[model samples]
Target: MSVVNPLVRAEALEARAYQLRIAEEAIKRNTLVVLPTALGKTVIAALVAAHFLYNYRDLKVLVMAPTRPLVLQHRDTFLRLLKLRPDDVQVLTGKYDPEYRLQAWQGKSRIYFATPQVVNNDHSLGMSLKDFSLLIFDECHRARKNYAYTRVAQAYISEAPYPMILGLTASPGADREKIEEISKALYIEHIEARTEEDEDVSPYVNPVAVEWKLVRLPESHRAVERTIRRMLDDRLQRLSAMGVIRKNPKYIFRSDLLEAGEALRVRLEQTPSPEERGPLFAALVLQSSALTLYHALELLESQGPQTLKLFLERIKSSGKAGHRAIVSELVFNGVYRVLESSDLEDHPKVEALEKLVLEQLSSNPSSRIIVFTQYRDTSAYLAARLSKLGVTVVRFVGQADRGQDLGLTQDQQSLLLDRFRSGDIKVLVATSIGEEGLDIPSVDLVVFYEPVPSEIRYIQRKGRTGRRSFGRVVILATEGTLDVNYLVASRRMAERMKKMVKELNSELHPIIRLGPAPEKKPIPADWIARAELPPSSPETAATTFEAELESVEKERRAKFNRELRETARRVLNSVLTAGKNGLPFEELCTELEEEGRNPVAIRSAVERLRAEGQLMKKEGRLFPAGVEAEIPGARRHVFEVLRVQLGEAILRVDDSFNAILLSADYNGPRELLRRGNRFSAISEIYENDKARHVRIYAVEELSD
Candidate 1:
């Protein structure tokens, strides 16, 4: 049976008893609805939203998610199910300028979909939530702590005259205290929770079969692991000797190291004598080094040798004292030599994954699969490995760019998911970014490259499958490693979460409304009139929305470009005036700040000028591009080799600026041009397309 209501479209939402029951309870009070993924959590929210809209035509609804894509997803869902005009339902994100968002907030939109951060920012800037009758927090597990959800919920509860909250999540958390914190934060008075095994939910859920594939680390890999373990032990022992940490090296956990570091920092802050502060500072460095080593060991044991190699490369390039210490000690102990000379291509789990994926696809050619990993490097490796074996695969990660690893933009991510849905891509190798409220139906198989310790992530990953039909989950783990421990921990925690929710649900007493229930009102005559009015054309409304969005984007870009150009002009002129002596970077920033220029804009302009070759930096000083040529001696700087072209090698400097090194000028081995390799070079700067380009006159490979 389908839900029937004026706001709801005809035969739009198939009525489910559990969802209706949950929504009925939710409408009367602020509630936290905990249901399994692929269930109707969103549907429950939509039904409740439709209820409020029908009964209280004068009030508005605000729905918030953590990400922009999720926000837009909710908007699409609402538009499809509700009879509201497009103009009456609005979506807000960080993409819109503050002024535009302000206007949108003040507009006549009856329902709003937005990300929490944007809403919190707007609230801070005086956007009121007093008119909103219902506030829905999607992924409300994030409400605890200082997350934006908590802040926004506080504001909405305090300001809205008739406040009502609906917090939604598949899994709140395994920790009872954290769940209670979320409840307190969101003002949750009741809980509506269901499981796959629940009477009502069982009939709706397709059974998802879960299997574990365990692999043993090769003996050669263990040798390398032993070396890293030795390094970690040395640091932990030193920390213990200094009284900074009390745990024995063999039994110490990462959390203990973190706590010790914090305690030592506090002790150092209170001490006045430099003599006493010196040992505390040394202990801090040792603690930091121990933490780094701990992480390195985990990566090697869980992710594999290749991922660890990448971590090591990043550490070698880092300027932090802890990072440098780890590199020095590892190199001294021949760990790098062993890793470089080892013939291991990947961890044994990779092979297990390959077998599982091949078997699944072989059995069902039309199946869609998602491979979830904890690290971007592992995602790339798995995607490339599968692609090499003739599988259609793509790496789906978040939008933050690492040193050389670029993430997919929102548009790109949406497109990739569309392709996967349409059977154009068979496998999606994703990081933690894919483990939220993304609605990807018909995913036949979900693979966990490594078992996550967090039960929330474990539940989310398992939920990705078994949506439309029977699904399967394959978790790859290494025997006698953190993989097994994490796997067991997540499972026990998930059980505990279920039990906790059940007890909490039983304990909560429903709140009775202080006044009579508001009478359901008829559809507003103006809304009916607007719905009756014919569109100017078939594409008129969509075109209008697109045009408006485009206009906002153009305005934003224009404003940014104006500020960037003005800042760049002033910064470049000031630097050029200083001549060959160059100006200190901080001095230039102080000068721009005095002029009242935006500090962020000033930084962006300087980076742009440096990239364009209009400006150059050396040893904490800025100079005009090509000023290096005026110096008599060779000026060498280390750079990470990005890639090699026909006659030049592209290199990254200071982990920000990109430069080119011509083959004719470089006198280093060709192998030095390999990506991820580092080299020092004496470079000349030139300008092309008003952007700075670096020309290497001399090069020397930096030893690991």
Candidate 2:
């Protein structure tokens, strides 16, 4: 094992003395380290890993993280800091060949950075974890029951001769139960919780004061919120009675509880004049979906014809009578009844978001910002509105493949991040996908279009900002709805976290203050000009030519209607039988099920083939469908869920609109289908989660 220079490795030692000291002490004993976001928790992991690596030359160091991205990050960091060669460090993720990974595992690689799932699967497959000297759990807070972390930790403890485990995270738990649960999962022997107040931490960590601002819901909206909350309560009771949800289920049994709230909304629509009913019904729908009344009002006002159009389309495609019924009630009996009577242009939150964007832009013209919203339709709505204000805006999303539309992709996410990093784009309007370990470009601000309930979400959102220096965060809340409740909940969570950290600290603490409300500014009428660049340059021409050639080849192949193509279903089944680790078997089965194919049959065929040795499995639970040398171009069709909006918009299907365009030159129906083609959209409707807009039409679907 290659060891990094003692002097160079020690440089990180001085940065966070308290964290390092705690980590060093903990290495001698099993430890749980809880630090807040941006607290350099990764640094502590590295320091401990380094200590183990240098001290125990006979055993390897294993770091188990929660996600592939986290694994990659840890692996890359260790390689850079410890000056280890790539080959010397093994990163086992769901993307690797399991057999290959096991072979490598049997070797002398000193450091193994992997997702817990990989470790668990390998151990299940008879691979041993006994050789590793140390086990580091990143995001140790997540090591609860049934998670892969639990299995891996148990196996390591059982098998390893020297069981040295280090648990790391920013937030271990909001309350004591969660913290204790985490400790038990990692078999933690000691707890080291540090705060910004500690003498050693004071210079490196800054205290942040959390402020809660309540935006009262208009009386009209407050009544609506109560009615829906009551409705959700009733449905929860029904679900519990049915055994679909047991008592104290982690979350509600049904995923679409908000949709159930529409029953109360129908009652509200019955009593209103066109003017009073239309807007009220719209507000009711948004509130029922867990959106703040403030946010709903903003959407009702600012997002025009297209917004309502998307809503109607989603219901129609879903084949869900309830959606249609609620929308009908809203329009005929409630808000839409008043659409002709009231002006949506004068809505307040629309004006507030607009003002917030402009003020931030003008003040920090050079600072990039990311605005997050709950719905794809809403994100598009905000992006369009912001673009009109002259700021360059990109909407980032995760692509959904099972439906007619595709979601944003990893590539689009990466491209936008790159653009933001290079100052090419000024603002990014994204969804929850932007909240995690994505290389989100440093931003000057984070604007929450609506507040979310998860404590993890709250930290991830806030953590996006204030990374380099003091950054601004804006939460847009609509008055008199769940928006107020959300604001209070988020503030309470942040405050609790702060207090927890302070209580855990070793020194005098100073309270950190949240930023004050700044003056709002209006969006300029002609703020943005179309981006200017020479069209169809050499690179562009080459790409177009290559695409055209590929298109022609696909067309030629489609015309032939080869036997291979006809038997692709059988072939895929055979491939699956031969291998189960690659192509995410469950995901493929789910996709096939969505396509109305018999997943059981498909699964059976794959299982049959696995006994035949035509397919092979890889380390990361990745099952490449065919043999590497014999079928080099064998590809697995992947899909992304783009945006969910009104049903019939053409631009939503445009390649440019997708954020998850990781694949190069995908087969798009738009190429072959004429205008107004009546083909199915890529994915099916969920009727819940707001029917995601698009699906990745299988390459075969394109030909059909």
TM-score of each: 0.75, 0.58
* RMSD (CA, Å), each prediction: 15.0, 20.1
In order, what lDDT does every prediction score? 0.81, 0.56
Clashing pairs in 1: 611-692, 612-691, 612-692, 613-691, 613-692
After the best TM-score superposition of candidate 1, give how far the Cα of residue 77 lies from its true spot, in angstroms: 1.5
> Total backbone clashes of model 1?
5
Candidate 2 lDDT score relative to the true structure: 0.56
Q: Which parts of model 1 are misplaced by more than 4 Å?
A: 1-4, 506-522, 525-704
Give per-candidate clash totals: 5, 62
User: What is the lDDT for 465 in model 1?
Assistant: 97
| lDDT, candidate 2, 1-704, per-residue tens | 22222412343234556765776676666777866567677767777776666555556888887666567667655543453433346667766555445545765666888888888887886688877768998877779879988888888878775577788876665665666577777777677877556677667654343333334343433333344344445545554454433565225523344443454466565766777666545545433433322233334423333454455455545544345544554455345433444433333455567777788888878888888876777777788888998889888777564254467554455566778778899888888777765444357778877777656677777777766677677776665545666667765775576556435434322222123222223222231111111256745743554454356435433532342232334444423333323455566566666765443344444444344443334552324223332323333332333332333332233323322222222233223233432222233211224433332323222211
Say which candidate scores most in TM-score. Answer: 1
lDDT of 1 by residue, 550-614 (tens): 57546645766787787887876667557567889998889888988766677667777776656
lDDT of 2 at 123: 81
- Model 1, 553: alpha-carbon shift in Å? 12
